[model samples]
Structures are given as structure tokens and as C-alpha cells.
Target: MAETSDQDSKTEEPTEKKVRDALEQGNIPVSREAPIFASMAALMVILTFLIGRGVQQITLTLKGLLDDPDGFPLGAPADALNLLTVVGLEALRFLTPLLVIFAVFGLAAQLLQNAPNLVLQRIMPDLSRISPLNGWKRLFGTQGLVEFAKSMFKLASVSAVVAFVLRSSEAKAFEAMYTDPVALPEMILSIAMRIVSAICIATIVLVAIDLAWARFHWRRELRMTKQEIKDEHKQAEGDPLIKARLRSLARDRSRQRMIASAARATLVIANPTHFAIALRYKREENAAPLVVAKGMDVIALKIREVAEQNRIPVIENKALARALYEAVQVDQVIPAEFFRPVAEIIYFLQSKQAPRPEKVQ
Candidate 1:
């Protein structure tokens, strides 16, 4: 077990990319407490605000039924159907608000519990879910044990709150048993309300703690190993070896273009065997001499060979060659400071006067 954990286990937090990908697959932190809390809260709302109205409506309905036994619209099929529709509409009008509010509360709780993410992957079937071994593990594993413990805790807490409420109101309840029928309902309702309110308040506290625990557990579950992080990074950026090869190919192609451009240069400035820069000036095209080709080492030698084949003059100027190679790029005009020196080289080549060529070292 320890060796297995050491292989690809994670101790670090999940990266943002990992979290986002998980979300896309419908993996998100969700607490069971959210649904329970929403249900309890909705129940509380109904008990506090709608219960009296519901009781009054029921009372009216019963009274209406009893008040005219003969006139009750069950005389014929048409009359009965009409009466049922009227009663159904009336009930729906009163009850729809409560139902809608309950639904809203539950939906709001879920939205607040998890970032809103919709993914079709969640509905995809998984064979593992139906496997007997997986079922057994779900029922007997650590998560199962925790759930059992939580259920027991909730049951005990609610039972205790109910017992406390009843015990506190025991005397009133006993007295109400012998009192007038009209006041008995009020007394019973009072005790029931107290019990429900206490239970809801207690459960709210439990739900809050459960929600925090669920979020922490989910984050831990999503943690990634070092290898996983590295793989994800590579997938996002690209493979390093492939990228290096591509760069080498690009540089070689660029070098070929530069060497070819050297054939049209007015002259080649050589830094012995270390560097070479080919200068080209077209009075109609450029305001200053342009470094048509530039290269180092073997590429410098190729640039010189190209110049020799084109009968372009080769001058030895170590400083100017190095400066041009370092400061200017192929096809770019020389800087203002190097203008006079490069212009003299261009002028010497254009004059058709063969200056003494520097010997190849």
C-alpha cells in the first residue's frame, strides 16, 4: 500500500488547469448538507408563513362540503367535473407560491454550494457504478462510515431537540388536553412550532460544518502528483524536444536565405574567420547601407564564399563586422553611427577600384 502511494500519489494542491478540466467533466465540490438545509429552510418558511393560511383554507373547504350536502355539485358527471376544476384551481392558486418558493430555495442552495457548471459527462453511464464490488466499497468504506456517523448524529440531535421542546411544554400540553377544543389546536401548534424551529436551527449548524468539510475533502481528492503536473504542463505548452528541433530547422532555413542574399551585396566586411556582414546600398531604395546578410562561424565562411563568387570586394574590419553582426540584422539599415564607415566601403566597391583583399586566415 505504501509503495503504491509513493508511485504517483499527490500531496500538492491541484493546479488551476486541473480544477478547470475537472469542472468541465462535472467534478465539483457539492455538499449533501446543501439539499438538507434547503429542505429544512423551505419547511420552516412554510410552517411560519403558509401554515395558518393552509389551515384556514382546509377549514373553509370542509365547512363548504358540510354546509350543503344536497347542493354538493356531485349531481351529475358534468357538475362533479366542474366542481373539481374549481376546487383544484383554488388549491393551486394558494399552493403554487409555496411550491415555487421551495424549489427556488433548493436551487439557490445548490448554486451557492458549487460554482455553476453544466456538463453532459455527468450523465454518461459508468459500468463501475453498478459493479457489486464498487457497491460494497461505497457501503463499507471510509466515506460510508462518515455518512453513517453523520446520519446518527443528525437523528440524535433532532430527537433531543424534540424531546426538550415537549418536556418544556409538558404542563401546558397536559392542561390543554382537558381544556376547550378551540384552544387545544393553538397549544398543540405552538409546541410543534417550537420543536421544528429548534430542530431547524440545530441542523443549520450541522449543515454549515458539513459543507466546509465537503469542500476540503473535494480539494484533497483533486490534488495532482508531480508527474501529473509536468504532463499537464507539457500538454499545454508542447513537447520540449520537438520544439527544439523545430527551432533548429527554422534557423537553418533563415541562414540559407541570408547566404543567398549575400550574392547581391556591394561588399563583405570580414572579422577574420569569426564574423562577416554583407553590405548592400541602392541609392533609389535605401537611405543608408543595409546589412543584406550576416553570420557567425561556418555561416560567416559561407557568406564570404558567396561574396567571392559574385566578385564583391571583401574588406577586413574586425570592429565594424562584429558591431554590424551584433547590432544589425539582415535586410536592416545600418545605424547612424556606422553610416560613414559603411558608405566608404560601398563607395570603394562602386568605383570599380580593386582594393587589396584581406588574406583568408
Candidate 2:
């Protein structure tokens, strides 16, 4: 049972590595609609301002037309042509800013969400857009359902507001029309205000619904099962066997390097039979001691070979070597606890001209 568990852990090691790689690369796909909703809310506020500005301009234009129809002459051929041109230009001017503002806001929303670039793939010969089946499906889909609901809600809300406004202002509205011609602007504004308010309220309700739907779908799409995540990692990386082979190759190379490094060490500490660690220290001018070489079994054997070839002294301190190997890594300072013992060993080795007998500490 223990052997089987060990084998299972070994098998999973490569898969774990692959999963970590995938996470670092940001290959994960996530929905962008939450940001879209937040941006739309901002857009709605901007639209309200734009609408008010447009209404003001339209009101002024209408007043000018009413006060002097001949001066702005809609009936004359040249005057009509000029008026049409002006109106067209004004419409463009109004729409351009709104379009630009909406586009910029939409882009910012997408950017915030880290949305991938969209690539258009023409699927099914482009007939799907016009197909009755597709149309029906869309009509029955969440978007279509929302649109239907919005239309009904707007109708109900507007009808209610209009009824209330008309009932409350019936007498005053009539009296203003009769008493003051200049008060036409004020009356027009009051009616416009009621209509705008109803529409704004209806829009707010629709936006809220849209936001809720977006959030629901975003969560649904982004939810990943553990198995699905595992599969995705596999797909993004490679099969487990290939990953395992790569890791095996890496560990072999690391073992080789460790053996070569340990060969250069002046002393090797061994755990008698199970573990071995080699350590080399250099005391250069104005520099602290630096470990030049260090390594376990096959690596320890290779270090021993290199030390024999170079005729470098090799001392075997079973306890100290095992402790150093377990507690300190290569290229790191020996722990404070082991420093004194290591220093004593180094001093003894330096003082001895011959290979010292195994010292039992």
C-alpha cells in the first residue's frame, strides 16, 4: 500500500508541474460581460446628459421655426434645401460624439476584463443570421425574452406615468396654452420632462435586468470542474508521459551537476549509509566563506571520484554531513546552529597534514 501510494505521487508530480505552467501563462478564458454591464451603466448616465442637450437644441430650433417661419422659410425651395442640410449636419454632430463616447467606454470595459481579441469566423455560409430557425431561437433566447419583457414594462410604466401627469396638470396645462404664448416653451419642457422621466425609469429597470442576467451567465460560463481544469492543463501542455519524461531528464541532469559539484568539495558529510553531502568553502580577500561544491548516493560517489582524481582531501563526518545536507541547500549559508561545528571541522582539517582518523564526536 505504501509503495502504491508512493508510485501514485510520482505519477502526479508531472501533472502538477503542467498545471502550474498553465496558470502562469493566463491561457484561461473568462467572460467579459460584468465589465460590460458596469460600463453600460456609465454610458446610460452619459446618454441622459446627451439626450438633455439634444432636446435643448431641438427646442431652440423649433422656437426659431415658430417665431419666424419666413425668416427660416421651410416652404422656399432653397431655404428648404439649406434647412435640410443644416439638420443633417446637426444630427451627425450630435451622433458622432455619442458614438465615439460609447465606443471608447466599451473598449475600456473590454480592456479591464482582459478579453482576448475577437476573430470573425464565417460559419455556415452566413445564412444563419437570416434563417427563420435561427431567428426563432434568438427570439426565444434570453436576449429576446428580456426585450419582450422590457417592451411590456416600458408600456405599463409610461401609461401609468402619463395618466398621472395628465390628470394632475390637465387644468394648468390648458390655462398656460391660452394665457401665455411665450410659456409654450415651459409647457413643452414640462411634458418632455414627464416622458423622459418615464423612459429613464423604464431603461433603469431594463439595465438592472440585463446586469443580473449578465452576472448569472458570466458565473455559469466561468465555472470550471476539477476534471475540466485537469483536461485543459493537459491540452495546453502535453500528455502526462511526455511531461514525466521531461522531468526525469531534468532530475538526471541536476544529479549529474550535483555529483560534479560535490567532487570539488574539501569535505563530505554522510548519514553513514542513506545520505551524503560535500562542502567546499573559499575565503577570498575581503569576502566571506563561499560554498564552491556540494551533493547524495550516486552524486556522492561521483564527488568522491573527483576528489580522488584532484587529490583534494575528503573527510567523512557522518552526523555533520547528514545534518548539513538536510538543513542547508547548495549556494546557501550553513545554518547558525551548524556553523560552529562546521568551522571546527574545517580548522581540524587545515591543521592536519595527513588524512585524520575518523573522529567520533
Candidate 3:
């Protein structure tokens, strides 16, 4: 169980590391609805242009028929068929450009908003697909209120534009009907263009406002509290208890390895209380001394057992051992200050000389 806990701790670090990496990337979340408003604005502009052009064309055709009905031959079946075909084709042509413009603008709006790449999940049906609770919540929500206001604003703006255009053109439009048929179509076309342009401009303003609102709401929804981030990390990885157990098991395994290595040490230096440091050196093979093992209390006892079993020398140096344990870590060279004393110990052992107990002078 301890071994498993140790393994878990080692694995947990990578998961946390990945979360940290993602946070560092600093991706800003966006609302899905913002693009819809932008796209609608683009579509409205296209519709305005197309409708204005179509109305002008239709007005010209009407003027041509009214000015000289015999010359245009509107009564013949073949001529009527050809005229209908031309009008139908012209309407399609007008609408085609608008369709293409809307499609491109919609795509661009989505891209600029940094929406997530299209995924199957968005299109897939789920239990919430038909939820009346969600419907009611949306209908009575802030978004619904915004939509209602937008509708009223559009209605009022269009009504005002129509009233102004009709009042200004009523005299001229009436005079043109009796004076010249061509002038009649021109007047009608002029009125239609003014109305369409007003509607388009109004739509653009509303959509821009809606897009801004959507962005603000999206940011609010994505804001994460510090505690929430922590909880998410824990869920993605595991709890602290499991991580602590794993670390303990790892330390135990490391201690076992250290003890096994200490058996080959030339000497064990002890603080005579808590610390123990074992040093090993090989002349002609190593340029400097190496620490084979280090520990405290129970770990110190374990180091002693390994040294004694291997017939390695043991020395009690309260100050030097503690300093070595504190200043140097395992598999590191002893500090320069302790080098002379440590060298003398090594020299005596290698030369088969008697052990000397000399205090630093």
C-alpha cells in the first residue's frame, strides 16, 4: 500500500504541471451567441443592397411596360413567358450575392470571436434538448429583455423612416403618375431605397450593441474563483492525502537504496545524535570524495547497520557530521573547510595507519 502511495505521488506532479501550463497560455473564453449578432448585421447590409437593386430593376421594367405597352408586347403568351423568366432569374441573381455575402461574414465573425473548432457535441441531441425549464428560464432572463428592447427599437425606427419617406414623396409620387409613367417607377424605387437603407443602418447598430453585451456576459460566466480552480485541479488529479502517502513510500524506497550504497562507504561520520553521513572515495578513479548515504535518527541507525556489516569504519564527529549533513546533500562533495580532515582520514585508512582522534586546531 505504501509502495502504491509512493508511485501515485510521483505521477500526480505531471498532472498539476499540465494544468499550470494551460493557465500560462492564458486563453480568453468567448460567447457563442456574439457571432450570431455579428452575422445578422452582415446579412442585413447584403439584404439592403440586394433589395434596393431589385426594386430599381423592377421599377425600370414597369416603366418600360407602362410607357409603351404595344412595343414591349406584354400580352403575347411567349413574350409573357420570357418576361416572367427574366424577372425570376433577376430576383435569383440579386438574392445570390446577398447569400454569399452573409455566408462569408458569418464565417469571419465566428473566426474573429475565437470560437472553439466545430465539434460534434454541439450538434448532438441530449436530455436538455426539450427541457421546458430551460426555455422558461431563457424567456424570462436578461437576454430575453434585451431581445424585447431590440425588437421595439427596430419597429419604431422602421415606422418613423416609412412615415418620413411617404410624407416627403407623396406630392411628387402623385404628380409623376399622371405626368410620366417612367417617373412613377423612379419615385417608387427612390422610396424603397431610403427605407431599406434606414433598416440596414438600424440593424447594424442593434447587432453591435448585442455583440458587446454577449462578450461581457461571456467573460462573467468564465470567471473562476481561486477555490474553484483548486477544486478543479484536485478533481483532475487526486487529493492531497493520496499524494502524501505516495511521497512517504518514495522516501522509504530512497532510504533503502541509500543504505545499500552506504555498505560500500569508506567511513561513516556521525553527529552522535541525529545525523549520519557516509563518504566513499576511490583514488585514480574519482577526482573528489562522494557522499554514499545520509540520514537522521532511525535512518542514522540503518546507515550504521549497513556500514558495520560491510566492515566500513565509523567515526563520531558531532560538529563535522551535522555540518556535512546540513550543507551537503547525498552524492555531493564535502565542503572545502572539511576537506583536510576528511583527506587525513582517507590517507590513514588507505595506508593501513592507525585511526587518529584529533580535534580541529
Per-model tally of clashing residue pairs: 0, 2, 2
Per residue, candidate 1 scores C-alpha lDDT tens digits across 1-361 of 6734763488778999988887889888888977887887887788778877787786787678789766765868998897788678778877887898889999999898776877877788989989999999888876789788889989999999999998999899789867899787667677778887898898888888888888787888888888888999889999899899999999999989989999988788999899999888788988988888998999999998998888888988888888888899777888898988777776665575775454332
The candidate with the higher TM-score, 1 or 2, is 1
TM-score of 1: 0.90
Each model's TM-score, in the order given? 0.90, 0.48, 0.70
**RMSD of candidates 1 onward, in order:** 2.7, 10.7, 9.1
Clashing pairs in 3: 5-246, 6-246
Could you give candidate 2's per-residue lDDT for residues 1-361 as a string of tens digits? Answer: 6734443444222344444444354433333334444455545655456766775786677678678777766666998899888778877866777777777777665565554543334233477799999999789876578668766765787688778777877887779857868667667666666655655555566556656665555444344545655787788788899999999999888777767776566666555444666667777521323344455666666666676676666666777777776787776656678878877877877777546334435
Candidate that would win on TM-score: 1
lDDT of each residue in 215-333, candidate 3, tens digit only: 66544434454555677778767888889999999998998999899987878888765888999888765667889899999999888878778777777778778888888878887
Q: What would the TM-score be for candidate 3 when compared with the true structure?
A: 0.70
Clashes of 2: 2
Stretches of model 2 off by over 4 angstroms after superposition: 1-133, 167-251, 262-295, 309-361
**Range of the 10 consecutive residues with the lowest summed lDDT in candidate 1:** 352-361
